[model samples]
Target: MICVGIDLAAEPAATAVARLDADGTTLRLRDLHLGADDDAIVAAAAGADGVGIDCAFGWPAAFVEFVSAHAAGRMPETAPTGKDGRRPLAYRRTDVEVQRRTGRWPLSVSTDRLGLTAMRCAVLLDRFARAGEHVDRAGSGRFVEVYPAASLRIWGLLEPRYKVDPDARAATLDRVLAAAAPIGTTASQRELMVRSADAFDALIAALATIAHRRGRTHPVPGHLGEIAAAEGWIALPDGGLAEVLRG
Candidate 1:
């Protein structure tokens, strides 16, 4: 069984496909390109099972619900209200940048948004729903899953060379390599390690790690179909769960 994970980063998305065979863990393929073209991505994920994507599945309605619900009562208000009354989700304590240039923000902000956070989850779910009819390759899967692929880096699952910061990545890698030792570091450094956000390739590497550790083989019947929506962890049809099987 092969589990594929994709680290979906904007700004020229990078895809790294990993495979764990009897020979051990191997990064089978890596591609850097624009991922908005769905057909290309679908074709790329030919004969694979399971995939995890690092992007908003759709608007995180749940997150919005939280903001509308407790944010007013819990979080302190910002500067004194001007002409208009205060608003919720306004001047949040969060550091979401107000883009002066392109007026665009990273998924970090969207991920924090209600209903928006699940956008990618919706994408994977949709793909899995159509896997049976669309995924025509023999032994290829027909299901999908959406995971916060970045969580793998947070969980200490990654290869060494891909680490951008040598000292820090290496140190974190060491912790990843050995779980026995007590974490020896300051709080701020630990925080950065926890939040190291390398989107696409990083996530793909993480999925490889998951499959290597806990994947089971299942014969995938050739099928093709698609299902898309805005929601949370759903077991998509055609075996599309939360792993990057292709593209």
Candidate 2:
């Protein structure tokens, strides 16, 4: 099976993509692209059996309502997250659920600068939808949402500090690639990951795609599936990522 993974960023220069080849057992990194744009992303995923993108697909249900109310020039009686005053509508139940499961807090797509990235992804998802690609909801669609950082922690791999620490970046990249041993890599791909954290994250997202496609993913609580379908859900390995790591 062929899966495409995209590490989308607010700026196209920071974006990256990876293609994974999984024969149902062993996985291989077939290609990697850096500094991609919307067209580039679509071209890369043209024939993919599955696609995993690292970005928010939808807004919080409350944020949706809040936006509508704000547009109507009326005060929203309830806070975005259904609470009282001052809580931002940034965290979705899936985000909260991920924190409950892994203790790593994902960035707020609504409040944080991630909104730009999500906006881009929203356009891309629409393009995919127009092209007849279905988002794999809970490992059932052709596309799915992915979170590489959380996926790394769930896989028992070293979660690295790539943005701030130059010294830590190389080591962190090494650990991530090492943990993804199931994906047969070459000398060049290793060098690429060593040079670009974006590439590394894209690779991790690709691995998550393979994991999800294989039906080895964890789903959100049943009650939240509806909201998650609209807001997007991060795909984590069901039990452990050992199966994907094994040679």
Candidate 3:
């Protein structure tokens, strides 16, 4: 099976892509791309059996409601007040579910600037969907949302620190490669992962794609699956139950 992973930054300069070959036991990094734009990302991902993109796929339910109300002139344009009295629209139910399952909170796409990346992802997903790509958000479909940081934590590997520190980053790369021992990597790929944190994340996302394809990752709970399909969900290795409600 062939899988593609994208560590999509809001700016094209920081984005990276990785291609993987999964042959039952070993998952190989077949190719890597850096500083990718939308066209480049789409081209690189073409022909892959599955794709893992590192970005939220949709808006929070409340945020969508807020936007609709504001657009229809029912509410003020300036950040419509959430129903619960707080800006509940700032975060999605799926984001909270991912946090409960992984013990790591993802940034709010509605309130945080990660929303920029989500906007980009939304366009890309739409393009793919129009091209006849079918994605069942709650299941291991043709496309899935990935969180490399959460995947690293779930795998008992290094988490957030690896990106900024050179030594930690190199060590984490080594650890990931060592785990996929049978798969060979080029010297250039190693250098790229060491020098570009985005590339390394793309690698992790590719690994997560393999996990998803192999049924090693968990699905959104039945109760929450519908919301996930509508609001977006993060894919992670199989763990505990994830509910839609956030406390």
RMSD of each: 13.7, 2.5, 5.3
Q: Which ten residues in a row have the lowest lDDT in candidate 3?
A: 238-247
**Model 2 C-alpha lDDT versus the unseen true structure:** 0.78
By TM-score, highest first, what's the ranking?
Answer: 2, 3, 1
User: Can you list the residue pairs that collide in candidate 2?
Assistant: 136-141, 136-143
* Candidate 2 residue spans exceeding 4 A from truth: 78-88, 136-139, 244-247
Residues 1-247, candidate 1, lDDT per residue (tens digit)?
Answer: 4444444443223333332221122332233233333454455455544444444343333345555666677633443254333322232211122122113333333334433324443454467566654321121233333233223333444444434655655555454434312213344433433344343333334343344234322222123112122222212112222332222
Task: Provide backbone clash counts, one per model.
Answer: 52, 2, 0
The TM-score of predicted model 3 comes to 0.88
- Candidate 3, residues 1-247: lDDT per residue as tens digits? 8989999998899999999887766667889979899999889878898799999888888778887887898886466454555446877777787778777668888887797888888888888788887866554568988888888777767745798876788998877766566666899998888888899999888888777776677777889878888888887876311110000
Residues 1-247, candidate 2: write the lDDT tens digits: 8988899998889999999887755778889979899899989887898789988777777777778888999965544443443243677777877888798778888877799898888888888778887754444687888888888788777545765555566677666656555568888887777678788889878888878877778866788778888788888776556675442
Which of the two candidates, 2 or 3, achieves a greater TM-score against the reference? 2
Q: Judged by lDDT relative to the true structure, which candidate is superior, 2 or 3?
A: 3
State the displacement of the C-alpha of residue 104, model 1, in Å, after optimal TM-score superposition: 24
lDDT of each candidate versus the true structure:
0.36, 0.78, 0.79
Q: What lDDT score is found at residue 212 in candidate 3?
A: 76
Winning model by TM-score:
2
* Candidate 1: regions farther than 4 A off: 19-40, 62-166, 171-230, 234-247
- Candidate order, lDDT descending: 3, 2, 1
**Clash pairs (backbone) in predicted model 3:** none
